[model samples]
Target chain A: MLSIRNLKVTVAGKQVLNGLNLDVKAGEVHAIMGPNGSGKSTLAQVLAGRDGYEVTAGTVTYQDRDLLALAPEERAREGVFLAFQYPVEIPGVNNVYLLKAGLNAIRKHRGEAEVDAFEFLTLVREKMQLMQMNESFLNRAVNEGFSGGEKKRNEILQMAILEPTLALLDETDSGLDIDALRVVSNGVNSLRRADRAIVMVTHYQRLLDYIQPDHVHVLTGGRIVMSGDKSLALELEKRGYDWVKEDSAAA
Target chain B: MSLSAINQPAAALDHYRALFASRNVPDDALGKLRRASLERFLAGGFPTQRDEAWKYTSLRRVESRRFAPADAMPIGADESQWIADAGHRLVLVNGRYMPTLSTPAPQPPGVTILTLAQWASHSPTQVADFLARHDHAAPHATPPTANGAFEHLNGAFSDDGVVIDIAPNVQFEQPIYLVHQWCMPASARSAGSHMANPRIIVRAGAHSECSIITHWVGDETAESLTNAWLTFDLGVGARVSHLNLQEEPSRSFHIETTRLQLATNAHFGKHDFALGSALGRSGTLVTLGGPGANVSLNGLFAPTGTQHLDTYVHIDHAAAHTTSQQDFRGIAAGRGRGIFNGKVVVQPGAQKIDARQSNRNLLLSNTAEIDSRPELEIYAHDVKCSHGATTGQLDPVSLFYLRSRGLGESEARALLIRAFAQSMLSTVQVGAVREWLEARVQRRFDLSAGEHS
Candidate 1:
């Protein structure tokens, strides 16, 4: 369902992803584990078509189509979701109103009828409950004065509402409490399907305690240097990334 | 002084001197006021940039042109339906009243509206009080005394106006509408120059209520000048709302001065909307004489095709516990130039006084220009006051946001502009008046934004 060929990415004129290649079929959960300065977040942003990043030498294909040619919102409408590590705060823009706009934009591109306020509210409430988010979150301004945990939870709520086929969970577990992490993990786990794929990015193995991944990749200096089963996460947790760097260089 | 620095009719001042010289003032309180006011006005003539309160706005529009007092009053009752919602109408053509065209409300037991000519002919003392208490007292009250030539002219030409008084604890449902319809006498040899001196005074008693609407219209094709000084007073525990709509003929000039007094626990507000004119400027001062008083000054201006509109509103919290809030917005298109200067002053010991001032402008094209200055002068120790002014084109992000949602680009821009301006509409408590002003804003957006947005 997804393919990447020698993806060379640079952000702010700094190389983040250097010569990385990957492929994943539909029906699989891939966890990308890397220490600091890894290209994990850059991969998520590049996939979502953020404005700044430059794909110096890469070609990304998703569902057999060119994924790099769309705008950020357009990519979102095409079922590519990037759960931001830190969401933006848009003042005077109602949380529900913004979410509704985002949803309708995606829905319209998919050739679906627009939902009315009442219907959208009902759908939002159910999704919020599933993500264990507060009802007031939908009433306040988008991400304005939100707590760290609240921001993380809001990303999950959006993911649930948009229900993207390819979800790039970019550090979704960062800053979340044990309870919030479990809830987020559960929300992600429930979306696993034979026709959907998810690529989770994180720096710690603690998230794997709840949402186990079928495959694990270690990103060092923007390239996937090591690919293994879930045991690689456990090995990294025990031996640290210095051993991974040493081993990758030796290989 | 450079002729280019002046803004209005030169003969307007000359005609004003002639009008007052011709009127007979009885030897009473009103006579004393008339004499004292002329002296003070002569001492402090038309304001200039030297006055910090009017630092950004030039009174040249009032000083340069030559105008003659409408010469002979022209008829205005061709059709009374023009202002149907105008509950109680007071018609004055060229500063002179015609009772046949006026429809005053029942006195409500204690409220009265006496013209300057009538009040001057009778009780001079009652008229003196108004003139004596007219000057707004504050650090900026003197306003550098930068030689107010037109003020002296307005003082000298004050032939007829009105004195409105409301007794304590009285409330009226209908707003007093003062309609000034002017026309340059077709036979008059004024040719390139014509002028009209307009005067109006309003006083509200303690705990009393009063509202007034002033609308200015002239022959759409005539080119003339106008000088006016409208004074208002509010007693303690009283509230007053004043609305001024200046829609001048396509080719005319207007310069007006407004003096306002606010007593302890009194609230005074004025909303000024200047839409069309060859050249127009409104210089006003509102004072808070008593503690715990509030003043709200709201204004909007739209000028097209090289039209010049300038508005200066100043508020003084002379006593403790007084508050002032001001917001003015303007749109200049077709090479029009719009200027707004607003000032808020909080006196010493006026702790807990809250004051805010904001002025914004939207220049639709490169040729169109807008200048705004919002000033705050505070001597009080514990007051909350802030001021800001910004001028720019439309918000591209907001426009794109709306357009992406299926609204056309023009519709998107109009919606955002309307939302930007709706802040002024929220203050009008009268439903009909609020909707009336809103209609003009909507109409303006429809016509102007259609071509550009």
Candidate 2:
């Protein structure tokens, strides 16, 4: 469903992603693990088409189409979603209003009818229940004065509402407590479908315990150096990322 | 002085003298007051950039124009822009009260509503006495150099306006809606341009409660100047809410000065919206004269195209245990320029005073500019005063976040712009006024964003 080959990227005149390659098929869950400054977040941001990042040389193909050529909104309309590590705090835009606008935009792009207000509220209430979010959150500004755990849950709630085909989670579990982690895991686990793909980037292996991944890849020096099954996350947690760097160097 | 500098003021003074002479009325008390005001305006020709209060705004464009007094010719004006279901309506066309267009519904007992012209014709001496008393009650809060040239001009030329007097202990249920509209005069094509000066004086007695909405509008084809003066005197425990909406034609110029006086336990709230006019300036001065007096000022100014909008606000805490708050927002697009200067003063004996001032601005284009200044003068040691100002463009991160949610670039920009303005729009308590303003503000930003992309 997604493919990246020798992705060379630079930010602010400095090369961040030297050479990276990754591929994921439909219905598969992949986890990318790396230490600090290992370019794990860069890959996710590059895939989501953020500005200020120059793709020096590489190709990214999504569903057999060049993803880099499309604008961020066009990519989003085509079922590409990125759960930001730090959700922006918009002071005046209500949370529900943004969700409705986004959902309608995607629906219009797909030649579908816009969601009615009543139906939209019903769907949102159901999703909020899954995320264990309070109803008062619907009326508040988007992430304005929200707690760390509440912001993460709001992001997951947005993900569930949008229902994207390709979901990229960047450090979604970094600041969540254990209970919030469980709720967020349940929300994500419920979204697992046969025709969808999920890619999670994390620095710890604790998240993999709740929502198990089908494949685990160790990213070091801006490239994936090791690929194994779910057991690889447990092994990497026990040992460290240095061994993977050494193994790739010897190879 | 230079050769033309001396001759310029002389020429301008003669022009006004001729205009005043043309009135040809009896030399009564009201006439004398008008002559005195005209003399004051002539003494201070027009404020220059040297004046601290007029530092960022220039009156050269207005000074160079020759605008005769607008004739009292009643013509059919488009009423589609008027707020629907707004309380008892009082319409003024070209500064003259239009009795045919205004609502004739009788006001409740203890509420007296009349035109300035009516009052002046009936009791000229009483009207003169009231004006003198009002002038003395609310002194100029600006610097010495910042003379009241336009206000004095209004006093000299104002022929008709609204005068509302609410008796003590009265509670006005419905707001008093006043509309000051301008239309193309029959001879405007031949004549260069015209000017209108309207005065609104509202006096609320002790323990009275009321709301006032003043709207200014003009025809697209009319290129005129409107100088308006409004004053509100609140007795002890009186409460008043005033909303001023200025949306003149693009070719028009607008200048307004509002002075407010609050007595013991009186509360005053004002919302000023300056959205149109080629060159617009609004000055508001609020004085808390007695203990437990409070005032809140909220304003939003959006200047698009070549429009230049300026708002100046001054609040004085003259008594003990008084409080004040000022929040203003400015949105400037195209080559427009916006200016906001807010000053707060706490007198020596005004202990336990709490004052806060905040001004935030957004520039939609590189050429758009906004100047914000917050000034504080404190003579009391036991007062808490805070002020802050920030001017910036739309947050790139916030824009990207919206775009990533499937909103087009222009849509994302429009949404963020509305978000910036939503805080001020939400403060309008009247439902019809709030919705109308919300639509107008949104449509404005949407068009600007469309032009950009």
Candidate 3:
């Protein structure tokens, strides 16, 4: 469902993603495990079409569309969702309003009828149950003054409501407590379907325990060095990246 | 300053020389009050930049031009079209009350709406004490009043301003729109620039509620200057919402002073939106006189093409536990320049005072200029006060973000500008007024796609 070939991204002339390649089929969950500064975040950013990152060379194909040509918001409307590591607090913009706007933009792009407020509220409430978010969350400004756990939960809530074909979770577990991680991973697990894919970016093997992935890719120096089942995440956690680096060099 | 040739010579300099000799001022107590105000105006002439409060907006503009204290010529033409948008309006022509054009409303039993000329002509019972209290001359005001040309201008022409008194427990649901449309026909044009000093006094009694929208409108690029002053004395538990919309023509110049005094448990809301004048300068001095008094002042302005707009807001925390929150936002496009200087004075023993002030400005073009200063004068030991000022262009990321969401460039920019102003407009407690304000703000920003939005 997703193919990123030889992708390289640079920020301020410093190469962040170096010849990164990954593929995920529908119904498959791919976990990209890497240490800090190993380019895990950059891959998500480049795929999500965020600004400030220069795509030195890359070709990203999502369902046969040239993903790199789309704007960040266009990419979003085309079923690409990036769960930000730290969501920007848009003051005076209500969360429900942001959600409604995001949803309607995607729907309009797909030739779907725009949901009215009353209907959208009902649909949003149903998704709210999946992430255990309070209905009151809709009233507050978008992530303004929200706690870390609440922010992560809000991200999961968005993923559930958006139901993106290709969702990228960038360090969504970094700030969550163990309990929040379980709830969020459970939400992701329930979202797994035959036609949807998720690329989970994490620094710890802990999140994979909750939402076990069919593929685990070891990322080091901006490239995927090793690929395996969910056991790869555990192995890297036990042995660390030095062994992965050595293994790649030997190969 | 260019002092005009006094037609009446030494006699004109004699305080009431212009009013008495020309017979422009009618009605007794109002006339007396106007004469007394001139005496006070003479005591304080034209303030200069040497004074701390007038530091940013130098009186150089007025000091450079010779101005004459105006003599009212009975304007033969009626200007009912100027108040076309207002629901209930009282027309004050040349500072003289024209009851003929005023819309009748039930006035409070003891409250009055008398022209200063009428007050002087009739010698009303409480008019003397009431008029004397709001004497624009502050004993300790910087540069005093004598050196302030605009104050002196208003003082000298004070014979025609209006006085409104609100009786206890009276509430006027609809906002009274006072349209001060001053015009001297093209035939009356003179060589030296002179001014019409228009004044409005609003006194709200205890538990009374009132709203006044004093709109200053003028000719299409008229060659005149207006030095207007307004003073509001709010009694205990009274609530007064005052909005001064300065929408004068680009050819006109305006210098205005608005003062407010809050009594115990009273609340005051004042908004000043400046969208006019070649060189416009407005100042407000608010005194939080009693405990639990709440005051909020918000101002917005956008100037373009050689226009200079200056605003000075001063809040005095005189009594303990008083509160005030002031925020002013401005956008300057083209060669327009804007200046905002706000200071919150927390006097000693004014403990538990909560004051917040912030002024943010947006410069849309390279030639546009904005100078903002938010000063916090804290003499009180126990108080929470904050002052912040920021000037910058729009955020490129946010701009791009909105554009990517299908907004055309102009629509996207307008949306962001509207959002920047929404926070201020949302604070309007009156529904109809808020709607009007929102529309006016959109117009001020020139958000072209307002209807579609």
What lDDT tens digits, residue by residue, belong to model 2 across residues B19-115?
8889885578887777778887888878888888888998878877777777747468779868887778899888888888888957899898899
Query: What TM-score does each of the candidates earn?
Result: 0.71, 0.97, 0.81
B-chain TM-score of model 1: 0.86
**CA error at residue A41 for candidate 1, angstroms:** 4.3
Q: List the residue pairs that clash in candidate 2.
A: none
By DockQ, rank the candidates, best first. 2, 3, 1
The TM-score of candidate 1 is 0.71
lDDT (Cα, tens digit) per residue for candidate 1, span A1-251: 78999999888889899999888778888999998888898898788766578999989999988889865666677777777787766544567866776688777887998878898889899989988888989878667799888888887788787788888888888998998888888888878888888999999999988888889999998899999889999999999999999998899
User: If ranked by TM-score, best first, what sequence of candidates would result?
Assistant: 2, 3, 1
Candidate 3 recovers what fraction of true contacts? 0.08
- For B298-323, candidate 3 gives per-residue lDDT tens digits of 98877877788989888888899999
TM-score of 3: 0.81
Model 2: DockQ vs. true structure:
0.81
